[model samples]
Target: MSIKLDYKPVVVLTDYMYDSIQPFQDVYDRAGFEFRPYQCKTAEEIIQVAKDADAVQVHFAKITKEIIDALPKCRLIVRSAVGMDNIDVAAATAAGIPVANVPDYGIEDVSTHAILLMLAITKKFNILTRTVQEGMWDYAVTKPVHRIQNRVFGLMGCGAIARCAAKKAQAFGMRVIAYDPYLKQDQVNDLDIILKSAKEVAQESDVVSVHLPLTSETKEIIDREFFGWMKPGAFLINTARGGVIQERDLLQALQTGQIAGAGLDVLSQEYIEKDDPLLQMNNVIITPHAAWYSEEAEFTLLTSAAEEVVRGLNGEPLKHPFNKIPYAKQL
Candidate 1:
């Protein structure tokens, strides 16, 4: 009986990832786990595909309450990205499954993306490119560009990515200031960035960048009032969650010229509709939420998520567990 009692974990991927799992298959097998990939897009599909899974890794699949309730054997959910907004975290918590994310996997990539957006907006990269393509090379048309040096680069949240962004901004000769209630004064001091309230940061910055997580309190934090405080002609960049800034307010602000331009990597909706107003605005630079991607980052993200599943199945602590729950039953 003792010899026969062995744990064989079933680690199911909620959706396909770019990184192949073949390389890590042997590692999982050695640890008494099996890795299986699925292309489940709906709740019912997820329930059918992962009902018997001991652990699951998610990329873009929405793990709803129905799927959570149906998975009787699932003990862990590891999101490939930092944001777990796509997954129903509350439902998973209630069901006693710990949710983990690869929070540090793409810090450099995301920070670089933030800087890229900032430079594009300041230099009018898109419109200038379009002008040249239209057989016009009027450099004066892109005149009136203010130097980034000596300009303020304001940040909303000072997490790992934000810290790197601050360092990069400073290297470009921009002054950095941040608004993050969670960080202590000493932490901000160590970064050599002035710590201020959100309103103050918005008012003083020449280029304001958002780098916060999406939570109930943070959703729509950058509404009309917050936008109203921003310095006129200042550009805005959001490498953070899209819901952090309200789209309606942002649209109004842009229409009124409250801000000079905007660069968004995420939107309230990931897929920008064909008729969206932002699409018509020549000042906005929008990317399809690809801030957290690089060959190395994707590999790290995929492997890290798989490792979390192994840890959860073996009753070990997860590296980047986001939620708090009492001792969960292990596989």
Candidate 2:
């Protein structure tokens, strides 16, 4: 069988998701790019399969400069999820390629996950579950719990997802405070959330929920000193990327009882080592980075990502373009 390799530009999807990529076929056909699905993980794999691609839609694949530089025909890169940390944006910028992501797809799920974690940590839900399973029926194991009302719920970022979380937390009669220098105080005020300094939020809140993005500035932003500012026996929750917290520092604080507990949906390393200290602590609730999951949410995320690539290919502004488009070389 002779496969035709005409002058038509190609759109390569870096990896597959449980959801179908069939929706993209019509978009690709209309945009003059042939939709090609390829399974690529490492930098080398991406470079090999996407070398001639005009636009690349990356799922869980790493888009390194080596791969970016190798793709001479590539014009745009779209991340399947909210975070663009998986891709080397600087390298793509240097190569004159624009980077875009779907920032709003999982706002409902992730925010709800944050609220769930907050309540579980504060109420000692895991401890109670384990104790009951082990034949201990006494409620004394979870004694001295404070009421949720009037407690400060601190947010690290007041972005779309965090805003949704604020609304949910407020529904529980909790005061929502946030620290996000990117947004003006009035913007946070519009959401009925008090804008405070990072330290102030940490110092005052009974529970701190992180919803910040992972950037150079935000990486390891929550270190030992930040933990020191936390109220004694306060709870910490992270539904955002994990690089924002230093795990060793978090463990130390937990060990010293400076912080009461943590609810981590992500970790500094997603492939947590077998001997990870946090794994042994009952106060710590560790999930396999699945906060943004639901059968419905997964489909939305995949479908939205495919649509963003079509926009990129058409040289149209995306739903959430992370950076200023470095170039306009479109399909």
Candidate 3:
């Protein structure tokens, strides 16, 4: 699509949970462009609102191929979050629109959340707190709780967040081991984390934490087979995508005593039914996909996403490019 000489470039935000868009507006104002925010849930809605947009900053809205094809002037597509699964990156690349994401904004917050989950589940915080609130002052209500020190903590994917989690676990005197085929032993040598095979990590760890992105290859990667490998008393933590572990398998594992407990920050489905079995289980701790949250992180996420739009408009390289494409010519 050719640009119109008289046309003013516009940036569209498909959706956002923020109470204010001022962070985005500030960046767009300095760049001298229009910043439009819309709560679009469907491709048709996005197409109608962003047809003339020079860039699109998306948060949770699915930027499908249909929406991508409709944006004739779209030079960039930026996901406000770390994962690009919500946006069709391949479609954007084929259309010569580079896709970017804010990957670094939530590193500390998410890693910290992972550690929180670890401690809460291992310490039986839920059971103890609930029993106490019920006027039962017996410590025996949370019987069989174990110490964290010197226990094996296995990580499924040793990315930045997992590495940070390792440091936190180490501070509590836990031994950290990880399994990530993408990394070599030398890469993690400085951190003192032992790299092991997936099976070995599952078999040896007192707690197995998942830190993988949701992709075709990783969907349901932690299923019955992996659970079978885990010790019957071992715990499981997943602050990453929920689809990484099969929910049915996880429930079965928790029921049959194959695994002790689970701490989940995300789910395969965002909304769980009121009577979901996972919620009924006392051994489970679930958060509302809020691992990547903090007042500071929120500001950083919005600012970085807006900056990507500015970079695209200025023909500058994206700080976190998800796809490679020829830079769009300046208007």
Best candidate (score: TM-score): 3
Q: List the residue pairs that clash in candidate 3.
A: none
Residue 254 of model 1: what lDDT?
93
- After superposition of all CA atoms, the RMSD between model 2 and the true structure is 3.5
**Model 1 stretches astray by more than 4 angstroms:** 1-5, 17-30, 325-328
Ranking by TM-score: 3, 1, 2
- Candidate 2 lDDT (Cα, 0 to 1): 0.86
lDDT of 3 by residue, 1-331 (tens): 3455466679899899998889998988887778899999788999999998888889999989988988888888889998777888889888888888888898899999999999999999999999999998998878899999999999999999999999999999999999999999999999999999999999999999899988888899999999999999899999999999999999999999999999999999887888999999989999999999899999998888998878777777778788866365566
Question: How does each model score on lDDT?
Answer: 0.86, 0.86, 0.90
* Candidate 2 lDDT by residue in tens digits, 116-197: 9999988999989999999999888998788889999999989999999999999999999999998888776778899999
- What would the TM-scores of all predictions be? 0.93, 0.93, 0.96
RMSD of each: 2.3, 3.5, 2.0
Model 2 stretches astray by more than 4 angstroms: 1-7, 17-33, 326-328
Cα lDDT of model 1 by residue, 1-331, tens digit: 1112465778888786574766456558767677888888788888887888887788889888888888988888888789878888999988888888889989999999999999998998988998899999897777778889999999999899999999999999999999999877887787889989999999999999999899888999998998899987899999999999999999999989888889999998879888998989878999998999898887777677777767666777677788864234653
Q: How many clashing residue pairs are found in candidate 3? A: 0
